[model samples]
Target: MQPGKILVAEQDGAFVIKLVGEVRLTLCTTMDDFFDDMLTSKGFASVVIDLVDATNIDSTTLGLLAKLAIKAKQRFSYVPVILSTNPDITRVLDSMGFDRVFCIRQEPVVDDEDLNELPVLPDSEDAVRAKVLEAHRVLMGMNDSNRAKFRELVTLLEGQCY
Candidate 1:
């Protein structure tokens, strides 16, 4: 699989993030930091996530996407839109209870204007572990199915932190 890459853009108060290639646990810190910055820096009226080019996305990346939608709802009363053309990805989203948090779409994002690549940040092991734990915790909170799905993995990840 190709390495993962994250791209982002802003239009007015609306922000767009595109996921390319394979997104995995290696990007946990970068994903976490982007979410933190996006939430705290300035409020967004809309957040769009494009996953059309994403070959594969692991649980950690999915969790961060969930976190974005949940935070957007809590902070701005908005449900972020996810643009995913791949049927497999849509199935994964459905399984993860993403329907409860994000507005999932199968079409490509109409507006590709102003999109820029987001730099991947270097992370320490501790930071990556923390982000992974927090992301999974958020996913587990979304519903019982997710909770059960990730419980064992979360337990193992938690053990690594200590």
Candidate 2:
């Protein structure tokens, strides 16, 4: 298996962290260290996690994400954002009640410098809701078979999340 890796990038005053290869206990301390260092730095208005390239992720890694979300909220005054193509991670987030915390993205944030500018709030609450709805629409557009698979994944994950 490929060694686990996490790369941090930023743009528009937002932070994007891309997780690659296998994610297991090996990266836990590294993740913790990264977040700890960011605590006193110029904080980003939003933090996005890109997980499309992750080959596999274990429970320790998920806990690491959850901790980062909480720490991000406390230190930066905003909850973390996440982009995950792995249905297992998404389901874990939902089952752990992190849906109320992080903003899930359909696509990974594209810019490498999302930290240069501040996060922009949508002009209206309706606009924000619209964005969320659009994202759900895209997520739902996956093949029915894959959607069903994700559903089973959700069920399996819920039982494991603690």
lDDT of 1 by residue, 68-116 (tens): 8888888888888898899999999999999999989999977666788
Against the unseen true structure, what C-alpha lDDT does each candidate score?
Answer: 0.87, 0.59
The candidate scoring highest on TM-score is 1
Error of 1 at 146 (Å): 1.5
Residue 2, candidate 2: Cα error in Å is 2.7
Which 10 residues in a row give candidate 2 its minimum summed lDDT? 113-122
Model 2's alpha-carbon lDDT is 0.59
Backbone clash total, candidate 2: 13
Residue 155, model 2: lDDT of: 49
Off by more than 4 A, model 1: 111-113
lDDT, candidate 2, 72-128, per-residue tens: 777766877778777876776576555655788757555544333222222444443
